[model samples]
Target chain A: MMGLLETAKISLRSLWANKMRSGLAILGVIIGVGAVIAMIAVGRGASLQIESHISSMGSNILIIVPGTTTSGGVRMGAGTQQSLSLDDAIAIEEECSAVSHVSPELSGVAQVVYGNRNWSTGVIGTTEGMMDVHNWSVSSGRFLTDQDVRSSTKVAVIGETVAYELFGSANPVGEIIRIKKVPFQVVGVLAPKGQSAFGSDQDDVIFVPVTTAQKRLFGTPFPRMVRRISVKARDAESIYLAQEQITALLRQRHRIGPNQDDDFTVRNLTQAMEAAQQSTQAMTLLLGAIASVSLLVGGIGIMNIMLVSVTERTREIGIRMAVGARPRDIRLQFLIEAFLLSVIGGIAGIALGALLSQTLVLLFDWSTSISPSSILLAFGFSGFVGVFFGFYPAYKASLMDPIEALRYE
Target chain B: MALIEAEGVRKVYRMDGVTVEALKGVTFSINEGEFVAIMGPSGSGKSTLMHILGCLDVPTSGRYLLGGVDVGSLSRDGLAGIRNSKIGFVFQGFNLLQRMSALENVELPMLYGGVPSRERAEKALAALKTVGLEERKGHRPNQLSGGQQQRVAIARALVNDPPLILADEPTGNLDTKTSVEVMELLVSLNEEHGKTIVLVTHEPDIASFSKRIIRVLDGSISSDEVVIKHDGIA
Candidate 1:
């Protein structure tokens, strides 16, 4: 039996002797492993980014929008019917044990003017609970109190984009802004939320009390009515339960009988976000699979070089065999040579991948994360590739006829 | 017991569907401590016989035995074990790994025998000393003369203290002076060390160094004779 140490030493010596050729052979593996790591890192980063966006949108939250209302057989889209209202949102929060917070909204696109600047942005009239439902916080001053909503105060909490457009670098708080020519005082600035999952700017809206919106800024078509209701479940697991309870309660309140088409739709944003996340995960897998092909190509390259090396060193093998080295010893030496090549490539490729990831972040502001599992995967896979690809050449070398090999020119 | 034996041994080669008999049912035996040379021209089957005797190749027909054990029936690994512990091979090209130092090359046989490194190194060095090349152990084969490389090969063959030494034209690549030196070394190993030697060569002058000479012609042994040796001062 050949000792592993001796075989390793011999392989190292031979590979080192032909450093140039070995380096060329290992380059394929290096590129392959590097590509795998970098691609997976980028893919994981994208999914993580989406996850953060989902969390920013809030967890265990559901949005309720009115169902379509057909007018003379011309079907109107969702949110066209005045089905949901502020009273319904309040009832869900008070009645359903699964429902934690509620924020009913009456929102529209409107032009707001402050100083010499005028900008068109989303104007959303919601209660103080909107902050908790959306997981949003105030950057400065304070959010709306319940008293402000009840009193129908002419006040606003503007988002970062809205603040930037209206007040530039100056503080928007304590300043008054006109919405449809009606002045409303700025109370606080909403903390920045970059972009939504749908690629819409999130920090380009202003939040006012629902009462103030109905009375002052944008009048509603009916009293106690709202366009949508944002409901937060007590926990992530109870989101579906909360949705069911809300649906049942709304159906009973609206006096809809069994099998009657509902006048409202309850959407669990968590489910939508999960679906989006699943697609991202699939994208990541696809990227890894594509990168794996390069890794496979690299394994093939190792095999090609190993076959050539065996052919080149036929006499060397004969000499070893003549000296009483068994076929297994020769096989082991060649296998070790191939295994060492890929392992070396794996180590170097990891370093290269990390460098590439960092370069991407620096050059393109892409978020890249190299998970420990990905590293392990690339390294283990490369080693396996070495053994897998090295097998054929080692077998060929072992089965050689000593006399014939020695006689080979 | 006879240290080497061949009974009706024949080797046939089939290449591109052409059958060529390299050895024809020949039989021979050599006891312990004898130096025998097999002489032949190219394609005379001397090399093939040497290979079979060394356990590097198995005969197509008949039993070839080493130390009363039929080697033809042994498995590949079994043959390897016999070759490793019983026979040392000295090839015409001096078959030392080019990049290894003389000591490393000498250590090859002992390495396969699974000897510990310290002992292997000691034995390799002693073998090199016997060949009068102990001081050149640090030099690689390419750095040494052809005769020096052959000495390393001989040291490698002798490292395991094998009972038999097989040389396939051991001095074929050396000059006259170097050939004489290598032959004297082999003669000393046979006489002073009691090693059974089987050598393949075509030169009558070189064959004269052995106790017995066997000449092969057209795949058959034509002559087997005891040589008249000239006395050497050493």
Candidate 2:
């Protein structure tokens, strides 16, 4: 039996003798592994970005929007019927055991003027519970207080983008900003949350007290009209229980019969986010599986080259056998040669794929995460490909008749 | 015991559904430290006999023994071990790997025998010195003359210090002058080292170098004769 290092040395020497053939043979492996790495990296990065966006909204969150309505045979979407109220949010917070916090929101797009600059942005009205429900914290000053909501104080908290646009690197706290021509003092600036999954800018918004928005800014004819209610469950596991409890409570409060659909829609954002994650994961696996076919094709290439090598080295095989190389030794020599080709190709592919991924990040701004497991999977898979593909040819070489092979021209 | 013994050995080759009898009921024996030459025409099965002796091929119906072990029942790997430790081969074409140096070619047999690297190198160098090619140990086959390559082959055959050496037209590719030189080298290996040698050749001049000459005719041994020492080492 040949030692491992000796077999490797012989294989390397033979490969070096046929440098061009060996290089071309391993090219397939290189491309296959590289493609697998790059595709998986992009998919993982996209999923991670989505998960961050979902968590930024809040953990274990549910958004309740007013149900659809119809006017003159035209059906409107959710939030069209203003059935959600601040009292319902308070009821959910007090009566639902799984509920952690609740915030009633009345939001609209409006032009906010500060000093001499005016910018059109989303304006949200809620209580101090808004910060808790949305997992948001102020970078400067304080969020709206419960007293501000109860007394209907004219105070606003600006998001990072709104602060940037209205203040231009200056502190905006204690300054007055006019929302819909109603003057409100800036109480805080929110820490930046970049973008939502819907591609809307999360930082380009302003927040005010819900009572002030309903009484002074919006001036709705209805007394307790609310557009949406955001709720947080006690923990991730209790989100469904919270949803069920809130649904029962709202159905009773609206006086809807058992046969009738409730007037409001409760959406579990956590469940929706989880479903999205599952789909993305499926897509990643699919992409990875498709890319793995290239590795098999690369294996076929190795087999083809190894067959040619066995034929080319027929005389050499005979000579080694006559000099006392056993069948296993001969087989191991060729196997090691194939393994070397694939492993070297795998390492090279990783380097190449990483370079390409970084280039994508720079040129196209596409996120790519090269995880360690993926690298290990790709490298180990390439080694398997080598052993699998190289076996037939190596076996053929080992089985050659020494007498006949020695006589071969 | 004889170094090699064969009794009623036969080799029949099947080619395209037709059987060709290469060796027919051949029987022979050679003692240790004896130099024997097998001589025949192209179709006389002398090469077939040489292959069987070298453990390169198994006979179809045979009782052959090498160093008191039955060779016919040996497995492929068993035969390989015998080839590594008990028998050495010298071929007409100087079958050296093109990429390896003379020293590496000489060390190959010992390597298969699992010799350590340091001792393998030392013994290979010593064998090369025996063949008077020690200075050309670093040269590849293409860089050496035909005679030097054959000397390298001889060094390779002697590296493991096998009891038996099998040569098949070892000097066939050489000029008359070089053939004499190689024959002399083999003669001295047998005479000075007490190594047993068996060689296949068609030329009477090559066969005359051995102590005993066996001539094969029609797949059977036709004549066997011992050279008289009266000629005083031809």
Candidate 3:
């Protein structure tokens, strides 16, 4: 081992003697590793961003929407067939084993007015459980109490976007807003939720009590009301169970026979989240595989240069062997030199990759995250490439006949 | 007992499908503390014979014994071990690693022998001092004059404290005065340090410095003669 170190020292000195060639050789590895890391990092960042957007929607929540039936291989929404009702929501909440909370939501587009400000936005009527189901929090004042629902009070909670548009720097609490010509006092303002992955403005909707919006605002009857019903399971693991129970309860409540096609669709947020995550994972794996091609090219470059180096340093190898160096020592010397080149390149590539990814995040306002395991994997892969690519040349060097090598011009 | 013994040694080279014999049934022996020179013209196989004696090449058919071990029967690593611990080499071209300083060049053999760094440093300095090159130890081969580079090579050869020192035309690249100086150093090393010396050269004046001269011609030893034995310079 010590002899190998001495040989490596001499080899490094030789490499340093020709600085331009050495630098160019290292540059090849650097570019290869750098390109690989940057490509994978960007791909991974984009995939994770997509995944988190989906995950932020909600974990245990499920949405039941009106379904579309196919005719002649063309699918069309079968309209509301009176399959879902407020009683179905109540029954699922009361009877289902996995159901944690359920809320019936009625939505419509309406012009909201506060003082001299008027903005057209989405208006929703729901119970207090809707806030908890969506994991929403009130930034100011309080949400509508059960007494407000029972009394059908004309009080409302405005979303942050509506509050910002109407009130600006003024607090919207206790302020009266007109929705469809009916005056309602703002009881709370929702915290900002930015935008969803589907480009929906989550904080652009105002909430009012279901009974007040159904009877007084929209004039829709209690049984023939609501656009969709949202349900939340106890946890992520209970989402499938909650979905099954809700479907069964709604089917029974509607008096639909077992042979008839269901009129409603149950969509679990956990399934959407899982789908998003799986696609991201697949994208990451694909990007990683593509990056490995560049690593292979880098390995080939190392092998080509090492072969040239062996030929160029034939006389040096002869001299070392003549001076008492063993064959293994000579081989190890070249291997170490190649390994050092690759490891150095790997570290530099990782740094450059991280810097570039962070710069993308800062400059473009993109979401990015780099895992520590990926860095370790990149480094380990480069070292392994070094060994794999360096072996043949080193072996060739060690196998040279000392006499013939000394005689080489 | 002789430190090196060669009996019925032969080396054949196959070049372009033709067999060319480099050494033919050469027999010779050298005892401890002996300074011998082999003289011949180009293509006389003196270099081939030197390579064989230094364990750099194996004879096709023969027996070579160094310190009672049959070197011809040993494996390549065994031969390398002998080269590392028993024989030191100096070359005509001064074969110092061009990138290494004189001190590092001198430390080469001991490094191969797995000597500790501190001890290798001490011995390398001492060997350089033996060649009167202690002050120039930090100079690289390209930085030093041809004669100085040769001296560094000699220091490297002696650093292992090997029993045998083999020089192949050691002064071939040096001027006449430098050649005499290098010859005097070799004579002194053989006399004062009791190192067995086997040098291959074509110069008759250089051959006279050794106590014995062997002449090779046509792949065979033509003559073996003992010359005047003067007390070597200390």
Top candidate on DockQ is 2
Q: What digit string (tens of lDDT, one per residue) describes model 1 on residues A1-409?
A: 6789999999999999999989988998999999999999998998898799888999999999998999999999998999888889889989999999999999999999998999999999999889999988999988987898899999999999999988889999999999999899999999998898788999999999998898887777787788999999999899989989999999998989998999999988788788888998898899889989999999999999999999999999998898888999999999999999999999999999999999999999999999999999999999999999999999999999998888888
Clashes of each: 0, 0, 0
- The best-first sequence of candidates by DockQ reads 2, 1, 3
- Model 3 DockQ vs. reference: 0.61
Query: What is the per-residue lDDT of model 3 for residues B78-105, given as tens digits with 9 covering 90 to 100?
Result: 7788888899898998888877889998
Evaluated on CA atoms against the true complex, candidate 2 attains a DockQ of 0.75
Q: How far is candidate 3 from the true structure (C-alpha RMSD, Å)?
A: 3.7
Docking band of candidate 1? medium
In the range B1-234, model 1's lDDT, one tens digit per residue, is 689889999999998999999999889899999999999999999988988999988999999989988999999899899989999999898888988999999988888889998988898899899888999989998899999888889988888889999998998899989899999999999999999999999988888899999999889999999987677522
Candidate 3 deviant stretches above 4 angstroms: A1-8, A67-83, A113-119, A140-151, A165-187, A221-224, A233-245, A255-261, A268-273, A355-366, B10-25, B41-44, B217-222, B229-234
Off by over 4 Å in 1: A67-82, A94-100, A106-132, A136-221, A233-265, B15-19, B231-234
The collision pairs in model 1 are none
lDDT-sorted candidate list, best first: 2, 1, 3
Q: Which of the predicted structures, 1 or 3, would earn the higher DockQ when compared with the native?
A: 1
Clashing pairs in 3: none
The per-residue C-alpha lDDT of model 1 at residue A395 equals 94
